[model samples]
Target: MYERKPVQSWLTDMDGVLVHEGQPVPGAPEFINKLRSSGKPFLILTNNSIYTPRDLQARLTRMGFEVPEHALWTAALATAQFLADQRPGGTAYVIGEAGLTTALHAVGYVLTDFAPDYVVLGETRTYSFEAITKAVRLINDGARFICTNPDVTGPSVEGALPAAGSVAAMISKATGVEPYFVGKPNPMMMRSALNTINAHSESTAMIGDRMDTDVLCGLEAGLETILVLTGISTRTEAERYPYRPSRIVGSVADLMDEI
Candidate 1:
């Protein structure tokens, strides 16, 4: 029998698993502290590409969790790494905020609107009609399309707002070209995260709140997946999925003793 090794490293989602609605879930801070003190390799992952890791670190700090910048990973970073690998020093027409722009710039990608190599879409609070129109025309001309994630809606105090996935769909409908998603639910994102921390699948566990993105990505990456019920998917909702996680827990607080 080919048995897998025990989990020595961890990857966890941020929104649902650790924090929800701009607040830290109960015991979330303690769980992070335990991981930090134990010297385990872990990354706090998020699909939101609007803010940089430093910005996220500051947000988490305000929520009473002391997460370092290096321990934070975003879809923007993964997408940037993918683009850099696919076409080093390539040009792109991007419609996103500081996070996405910063990552692409760091990877030596030149952002432009004139006959660029790719049309990269990411999350942003302000979605301009002119920018979307430009992206649509650019893709129609010959640029490849890439998106950071497939999340259609994002939560806000007001309600759910259209996100990058929604905008990508609009552009696709207009140009008849689909974007290549590089975030959660795509194993590439998980692989990039693992590579960032030099962690192997056999000894790593992925803890997420959603069955679709987090659990699916982790499973596809050959890592043990744990679904926590602190966010989106409930135990009943999870049962409807075709695939199953390695285990289910009520919250991150439940796994504190293991660390």
Candidate 2:
């Protein structure tokens, strides 16, 4: 068993560890409040590329969470930041939603339909054949490919929906080029979050539910990881996996108790 240590900062996964289907896990708010009261800094790190920081803050607040806009970090934001640093003012072919487009534009990327320098792939609920074809043509012409994350699907009340990874994989199959993933299980997103908070890896703990993405990502980044059971992962499933978190708790409530 891994012993718990004193952590000064936290990097939390939003969808599973904090809430589920727009509902806060039991005692989640109080748990977060306790962290704040204890003077520990935390940021909600998520691979979901659908929403901007302000949008996520509103959604979480409506769900009874006291999340501030600055406390949230999404893959979309990390991708935009990366693009901004690598190819500022470059034209991009976006196969994503308004949130992604907004982030890119905010970071000085130009949106264009012709001869784009980059092809950014993300989830689109209303993805059309025309859009896919256009993106493929751009990639075929040698545009750099970038994907928000590699998650095949996202959990929802109705079931799973095709995520950015699935769409990016389809495009890669058509163009014979793999995309550079910018989300969890990749170290870039974690680095971006740490830089955002000016926090060091040793002092930060990543609280999440999924072992493959969340816990593994944290461990790979050398951050302490805490696994919660309120989302896609169960204790039984975790036992069967090779990657183990630094700690396991029943829920966010249990996490608060341990911390």
Candidate 3:
């Protein structure tokens, strides 16, 4: 018989761990409700920079999850916080939705096209070639390049759509300058998520659906990693990576007892 360690603090990914294809994963709400009732800190982590915490909360609510707006943490918020620390009161030329723009605005960053401090890229419904061309020119003209996440594509009803990383690559290819990617697979964003809840890596458990991003983020950030098969990653796919998750479950439904 094996004795499972207790979860002191928890972090779970949004898309596949809790909900899949805009619907709540079976038992996700119960798991979340357990976390909420237990009095321990928890947050749903997302690499998406297109929607704000409030937006996510509402979406989750519509899907039957009662997550608070504060219970969600996004890559956009982390990127804005990073920029604020790195270069305070700076200007940028941004390509993103309200989530990215709002986060930057809260951090006192001004958005402009002319002689900005950075050319920040994020997830958007449409990636305009004209905007990307301008971004390349901005990089050539000494503006630093930054991207919210490194996800090359995102899931859609129609299939995977080109996302922030893909657009960033285009700009980089044109300008011969690589943009700094701040979302998962990068440990900084994980650290920021932990910091947001004042949680320690040793005691915190990170539940994610993807091995490359979620598991990697947790492992690199020094947190225990759990991989759920409810999303894009599979059991065999997880093994292909050099790094392994601390545990792998079929779905969030299988995690109730452990938590």
**What are the TM-scores, per candidate, against the unseen true structure?**
0.98, 0.95, 0.97
Give the Cα error of residue 192 in candidate 3, in Å.
Answer: 0.3
Query: In candidate 3, which residue ranges exceed 4 Å CA deviation?
Result: 1-5
Per-residue lDDT of 1-259 in model 1, one digit per residue for the tens?
Answer: 7687888999999998999988899999999999999999999999999999999999999999988899999999999999999999999999999999999999999999989999999999989999999999999999999999999998886879999999999999999999999999999999999999999999999999999999999999999999999999999999999999999999999999888
Candidate 3 per-residue C-alpha lDDT over 25-138 given as tens digits, one digit per residue, 9 for 90 to 100: 899999999889888999999999999999988889988888889999999999999999999999999999999999999999999998999999999998888998899998
The pairs that clash in candidate 2 are none
Better of 1 and 2 by TM-score: 1
Best by lDDT: 1
Residue 159 of model 3, lDDT score: 90
Which whole-number lDDT from 0 to 100 does residue 56 have in model 1?
95
CA error at residue 91 for candidate 3, angstroms: 0.7
Cα displacement (Å) at residue 246, model 1 = 0.6
For model 3, where is the 10-residue window of minimal lDDT? Answer: 1-10
Residue 164, candidate 3: C-alpha displacement in angstroms: 0.8
TM-score of candidate 2 against the unseen true structure: 0.95
Worst 10 residues of 1 by lDDT: 1-10
